[model samples]
Target: MTAALVEEAVKKAAVAWINVGAGPARALWCLPVDGTLIVVSGPGEQTAPELPEATRATVRLRGDTGGLIVICETAVARIAPGSEDWAALAPQLAAKRLNASGTADDLVARWENDGCAIVRLTPATDQPAAAPALPDDAQAAPPRETPARVPVRRPFRLHRVRRR
Candidate 1:
């Protein structure tokens, strides 16, 4: 039942914010397939997650009432490109991509042509639902420093020309 709930929420939610290892949360386009959540990450894809070949992740979802729902203890892995599992999950993943440039087939081809990593996040074992906790340092990074003085440009005026 817990697994089903996790899968359902993942598929229904527009974005799944997952945290792998000690990294911060990342909102990604996720698809729940074969009892697991799959996410594509690359330069041009949804988000470039820091997940390696294998790791654990925590997925954050939403309930019907726009409340927080957390699916914890997820095992993460990067699927091999062009492998059987990757091919099977490609169409489903591509379909969920909002405003994808081309057809499902084309998207898969592009993912392959590019060095995109198709990451899979599945339940590590039998785990119950729980509320997610805020990170210790929840504040965003500081903005870049800029020069104190600023330059101002004068506005230009348009001149009317006489008709010939």
Candidate 2:
């Protein structure tokens, strides 16, 4: 039952939250193909650090209402460039990628040249890690460390404009 649900969710959804190793879950655009979810990450693509080396990951799919639907563990496999799988799936991924910079063939060539990681996530379990009943606690994480910061003060106005 759970496996069927997972497959259904993957087929219907275009995005998923994936947590690899110790990193927090990151939302990624995904494509469902050959009964697995395909995600591209690296330069010029979504950021999923260490995913190529990861053997397993946790994937969460949300329903149309924007609520958590299911969380499941998946086995990770990296598809080699120029392989049969890559030749078949790359065009599809590029076509579905929103706001892509170039044509599907160009994107595929760039991905290969840039060493982008194209991984397939296959559901590994029939039972979900969490699902059906939502958890009470809000699963939010602290912002990642970065040099960027908000301005300390608002911009000074020469004079406040009075509104009618």
Candidate 3:
């Protein structure tokens, strides 16, 4: 019953916050395939440091209302490019990627060329994946430091001169 809930929660959410090892939880777009979640990380992709090397990770999914839904421990497996699994799954992942620059094939090629890590996250059967209850306090944290910044607005011409 709990496993079903985990699967249902995962199926509904497009993104999940994954914490690999002792690192901070990072939001990653996920693709559900064959009862597992597929996540890609590397250069020009989402940042998930140590995910490919880590054997285990914690996956947190949010509800439709944007609230916490379920938290699960997942077994991580890195799928090598050019493998049978990669061949089948990469196209699916590329199709699901929103705002992707190129065709699915092109994106897959780029992923391959850039040496991206395609990881499969399987929910662990032994560990409890679901949270007992929703917490009363708001789960908010200070924003992480980044070099990227918002750009200034361009000048607007409010009034137009009337032609004689």
Candidate 4:
């Protein structure tokens, strides 16, 4: 899918889960590469479980600073198909085209093995886009042209009084 499509899917999914606090915070910035979602988290954030088959899936969160919590297949088999929350969330997930990938299957297996629920986000059709590349010798834009500073001299009268 196109970058625009992926971006749209992410935006929609983010909006749906932002209030619910159900997806990975750091993974929000992650993009799918080589059939896996690459997420970079701060030092203390929890590490994602190793995925099984590396399938495309929606990611979700349970806490603010706990790192990405869950990843799951796009299909909502375990989740009730058409509840109010599910209905509301489905479009966003659909937008991303979430689906089971080898990676996703692996994640599910890991979660099951660890006795953790697979966190899922709204599916997206396209994977997130790669970050813009920077030139090797890229330089900061030239500082904005500024007027030369003019020294101001204040004229003041000094009075000296002799005290007897």
Highest lDDT: give the candidate number: 2
TM-scores for candidates 1 onward, in order: 0.71, 0.89, 0.84, 0.20
Candidate 2, residue 44: lDDT: 89
Candidates 2 and 4 compared by lDDT, better number: 2
Residue 92 shift from truth in candidate 1, angstroms: 1.8
- Lowest summed lDDT across 10 adjacent residues in model 4 is found at 14-23
Which residue runs does candidate 3 get wrong by more than 4 Å? 129-135, 149-164
* Candidate 4 residue-wise lDDT, 36-144, digit = tens: 3333212222334432222344444222343332222342223233455334433333333345344644543443344432233334444432223212443224543
Give the lowest summed-lDDT range of ten residues in model 1.
130-139
Which lDDT values do the candidates have, in the order given?
A: 0.74, 0.88, 0.86, 0.35
lDDT of 1 at 134: 32
Model 4 misplacement above 4 A: 1-24, 27-109, 123-164
> How well does model 2 score by local distance difference test?
0.88
After superposition on all CA atoms, what RMSD does each candidate show versus the true structure? 7.6, 2.4, 5.3, 19.0
Which ten residues in a row are the worst by lDDT in model 2? 129-138
Tell me the tens digit of each residue's lDDT in model 2 across 49-138. 888999999998987788787888899999999899999999999999889887999999999999999999998865785464556667
Any runs in candidate 2 off by more than 4 Å, and if so which?
Answer: 130-134, 160-164
Give lDDT for model 1: 0.74
- Give the CA lDDT, 0 to 100, for residue 112 in model 2: 98
